[model samples]
Target chain A: MAQNDSNTKDMILSLNSIEVLYDSVLLAIKGVSVEVPRGGMVALLGSNGAGKSTTLKAISGLLKAERGKVSRGEIKFDGKLIGDILPQDRVALGICHVIEGRRVFDHLTPDENLEAAAPISMSRAKIKSEKERMYEYFPRLAERKSAQSGYLSGGEQQMLAIGRALMTQPRLLMLDEPSLGLAPFLVAEIFGIIQRINKEQGLSVLLVEQNAVAALEIVSHGYLIENGRVVMHDTAGALKENSDIQEFYLGGGEGKNFHEIKHYSRRKRWLS
Target chain B: MDWIFLSELTVNGALTGLLYSLVAIGLVLIYKSSAVPNLAQGALTMTGAYVVLAFSHNLGWPLWVAIPLAAVIMFLLGMGIERVALRRLAGRPIVMILMMTMGIDIFLRGTTLAIWGGSSRSVNLGVSYDPFFLGDMLLSRIHIVGAAVAIALFVGFLLFFRTRLGIRLRAISDDYLASWSIGISVERGVGLSWGLASVVAVATGVIWGEVQGVDQSLSVLLLKGLTVAVLGGLDSIVGAIVAGIILGILESVGADFLDPFVGGGSRDLIVAAVLILTVMIRPHGLFGRHDIERV
Candidate 1:
């Protein structure tokens, strides 16, 4: 609700010169800074081990544990300095990190999984209303509420992870490789839900992805990271059209050539 | 052979089963949260009984003042164990932690020997109520009250698990990193779990003292607690309680009825057999989530 609706202008998260190192030798990310305004999706694109995941982890406070220390940097979320804050405290300050691999609480039922992210103190009606609204966005989750999260399909599990994060009512949601290991149809479905969450709920997102073409289509702004530094920062459209991006990521596909590939992306439109 | 005799035996077994459940349930709580088999649990229970004996008998405190104070002291002791022993070793392999707890058990047993001078000490609550006769049977009032308290504590624990804090504990058991990320204070929760387990141990010790008298050897009751926990399921509170009752009843009834034919003392053998069967049938124990390994 703090995000802009009509004009759609607000600064939700600001990373000022974050330098993340792993084990004092492996520089996962260095001297990177980016701003994600409210109510829009921004993609951090990179290859495997290119520090895309590391950047998201730095913001979420997960990277700090893996010797991925933020040696010199500051992370400000919703006007608060969060670099020294504990991960759980960061979660309390309205930043939800949907970790990669859809790592839900597998022992819990889907409803209990959502309930885990519920604030330590809340009235019953407020909890109910928020759950109802989340169900509206993800009706499939409602049907599977009684099922254990471990039993869900990959796409369903991804939906449950996102829905559980939404339960906390975060201002900025940072998702790491949400499209990993999903069928093409589920990936597109997830992206569609991400777009809706931003537009309707006025949520801001810093999306990290290995699937460059798919991620570029969903977000407004984009950054390319390689070995712990940002190499490309531009509008999503510009990144999509960059010749190097096409050669390395999109397999030399131009506007005309993109129509011929029959892969996971095509399956979303034709198969499902 | 008489019907009246059979009814008396059934009531006695049921009473004993409730106390066993109290001790075993404590083990289940610790194992579920920290994944360590507490070899020190029996020692802790024995320590609680000895603490009460010292306060009421050696130090001249009234029974009313001694028992609750002993339980509180033991609760603090349990928290100390968590902070000093278990906290540093969390996330280590299960075998090493088990060995550490075993070492704690040995240390506690030695301390008990050194302080109590390896001698038996009489523990009396000074309740002067007479045993009442029903038909051909006599039942002591102390046993009845102890059984009632144990059952009540078990019910209270079931309710605690339904509250928000209880759910948070279960979430930690489900996934540690995920629970921490969601704002559940893992260190605080672990400490509280240890404290609760200590309270249960004190209750178990008091009842055990009443039934079997008190001595340094009374620490062996920890073995019974471990057996119950293993049979019931290490991580399941309901399973631990149920298994405790079942094992207790089995041992009591076996000693009473079958001892005549099985050379007069095979109750422990029956318990050992049941434990083997439980482990073979369900390694995770009854009600425990089967740990599914994915590569």
Candidate 2:
């Protein structure tokens, strides 16, 4: 970790050529570098097992629980190198990760779930107001607030998961597949809200999604990862315009699905 | 048939059931947060009683001072067990944790026996042994006081789950990953559960110790408490109390009526039977929640 990295200044997050390993074997991240400008929304677009989620987990200190560790390079949040901070302590530093699969406490109501996510010292008055703000941000959650989160629809649960993250009042919100398993309209609604939050509150968001088309619409820039290495990095507009991205990710060509084998073969040729 | 004796037995058993509920509640707290059955719960109960006995008798501390001091010590010991013993085995299989707690139970049993010796020692908390009459039934004053304390602690625990810290504990039990990502200190919540469980176990030990005396046999409480815990649905607090009362009544009535027909003691035997039956019939326990499987 470079203690005085002059280049990381003005950036909210800078992943400095980091590598990750699951267990003692199986390297999962192969020296990937990415950056999120202050208050910027960035997307990590990749197919399954491309290490996008692992990168976000690395940033949030969630990898330790899964027997994964940052084996090399540094993760600097707010220009400070990530250290031996517990996952819960990352909340104090304003890093909130809404993990994949809309993981809310099913036994609790949305209200309690939000309250549960709040810092221990958060006052009732502040929590109530923050909850109200969350409700305003997602009216669907407010309508279903009385019911247990288990009964919530996939879209509503994702909204509640995001709302719970917001209750922490985090400066950086890392979302893992927020659009997964949702209708197109609901995806647009969620992505639109995320865009609004980014613009209004200036909350830096690092969104990891396989749904490149939807993610590209809301994020300012995007990184395309293939087999643990970043293969492409560009502005959303440029990525959308790229011929390879069009055939594979943006769906202007091919069957609107990532041709994984073809893409891997192309990466092989490109690496050579 | 001694109908009056049966009714009296029922009442006494009900009060004893409350004490068992108190002990079972301790087990539920640990299993609730960590999803691991704490086999050491009975050892904790026995250790708590001996600590109080040592303080009040050997150290010559006042009864009022001895119990609370013992409670505080047990609380720290419980948390220390989590931090020092359990935390080291984090992310291991549930079976490993299960074995770890069993090891702790054995360790606690040996430490208490080594320090206090195996002899049964009684601590006089000044409860009157004179049997009091109520509607043609006899009641011990100590049983009434024990029931009162158990009820108060149960009420306190009931109120606790509604608070912020309590909600966090419940949330952690529901989803460990989500809890950590949401900023909940899962480790602390688990530690607190152990601490609270230890505190309740101490209360059970003190109340029961007053009547039965603290002995190596008191460690059998783990079996009794485990039966109540399993019967109540290991995760449910209210279930523990309900199961405790039921077990108490059944034990008392069985001892009175069936023990004579059988060879000798059947009080503890009944609990073991119920534990086995509950597992075979309803593995989730009566009040325990089924896994909230996301469809």
Best by lDDT: 2
Any runs in candidate 2 off by more than 4 Å, and if so which? Answer: A1-7, A252-272
lDDT string, candidate 1, A184-247, tens digits: 9889988998899899878999999989889999899987776666766778988888776776
Per-residue CA lDDT of model 1 for B18-117, tens digit only, reads: 6777778888777766556788888887888888888998899987788899888988988888788877665557788889888888888888778877
Q: How far is B9's C-alpha from truth in model 2 (Å)?
A: 1.3
DockQ-based CAPRI category assigned to the predicted complex of candidate 2: medium
Cα lDDT tens digits for candidate 2, B1-295: 8889989999999998988887888888887776779999889999999999889999999989999999999999999999998886766788898998999999999999899998888989899999989989999888999988888887888888888888888888888889989888878888999998998888989988987999988878788888999999998889988998899999999887778788768887898899999999999899997777667
Each candidate's interface RMSD (Å, one decimal) is 2.2, 1.3
As for candidate 2, its clashing pairs are: none
RMSD of 1: 6.6
TM-score of 1: 0.86
Residue B52 in candidate 2, Cα distance off native in Å: 1.0
DockQ of each: 0.35, 0.73
lDDT of 1: 0.77
What TM-score between 0 and 1 does chain B of candidate 1 receive? 0.91
Q: In candidate 2 chain A, what residue range of length 10 has the lowest lDDT sum?
A: A263-272
